[model samples]
Target: MVRATMMSKQQIAELVEIARRDHTLWAALKDRELDQFNQDGSVKIPSISILVEDFVKERCGASHNYAIGSLIVALRLPIRQELGLPA
Candidate 1:
């Protein structure tokens, strides 16, 4: 079991960027995607991605990770703010 390590906010930010650009890769991230052996062994996978997508897409009825990832990165990137996302 490959253990997962704690990632810094920058790392999360980087991942947000990566997942935002690559839809396929972003979609691939799942609760079990990370290594099972966490270094701290106290890590808990966040459902933030799914929630972010829903918030961005405004599809609260159905969750979309890709759209969510894009929104997160878009907000962080400051380039695609014009996209049809609620302020």
Candidate 2:
């Protein structure tokens, strides 16, 4: 079993900042395809899986599952922020 390396807060923050500068990546975070709407019209955000998959395909060029895992770690902060979670 391969263990994933944890990203430091600073590292996560930096990655988030970098992602913010990328229009495509930032837009993916806000895309409706990745969201679920409730009966009350409140939104339930999907996990970052789709975004990570897209990121890996466009940037990492790695087809392994680990690429998605690594992306989730790197983009954790930004993903949470997009979901309106407290950072």
Candidate 3:
């Protein structure tokens, strides 16, 4: 069973906007986390490092947009691999 994590609609909408604003800005923000489920059979969310707490707070639903943006800014970011499937 592949259970999904809970995601926020508002955050997703914002992420979409961010992607539109800059062509490749958020190209790496796919919503799909690892397929591994928790011990309870629920899917796990992507964990952000403590280094990016402020960025995480600014984002919603694990805010891949914010994380990606921060990564871009730090020049140490990674791209999305979920095939554009945001929460």
TM-score of model 2 vs. true structure: 0.48
Backbone steric clashes in candidate 3, count: 1
Pick by TM-score: 2 or 3, better one: 2
Task: For candidate 2, write residues 7-38 as lDDT tens digits.
Answer: 45665455567777888767766564345565
lDDT of each: 0.43, 0.59, 0.38
The residue-by-residue lDDT of candidate 1 on 1-87, one tens digit each, is 444334346645655565567665344343223332356876444444544544434432443233234445443443223332333
Best of the two (1, 3) by lDDT: 1
- Which numbered prediction scores highest in lDDT against the true structure? 2
* TM-score to true structure, per model: 0.27, 0.48, 0.25
* Weakest lDDT window of 10 consecutive positions for candidate 3: 72-81
Score candidate 1 by lDDT.
0.43
> What residue runs in model 2 are displaced by over 4 Å at the alpha carbon?
32-47, 53-87
Backbone Cα, N, C clashes tallied per candidate: 2, 0, 1
Q: Candidate 2 — which pairs collide?
A: none
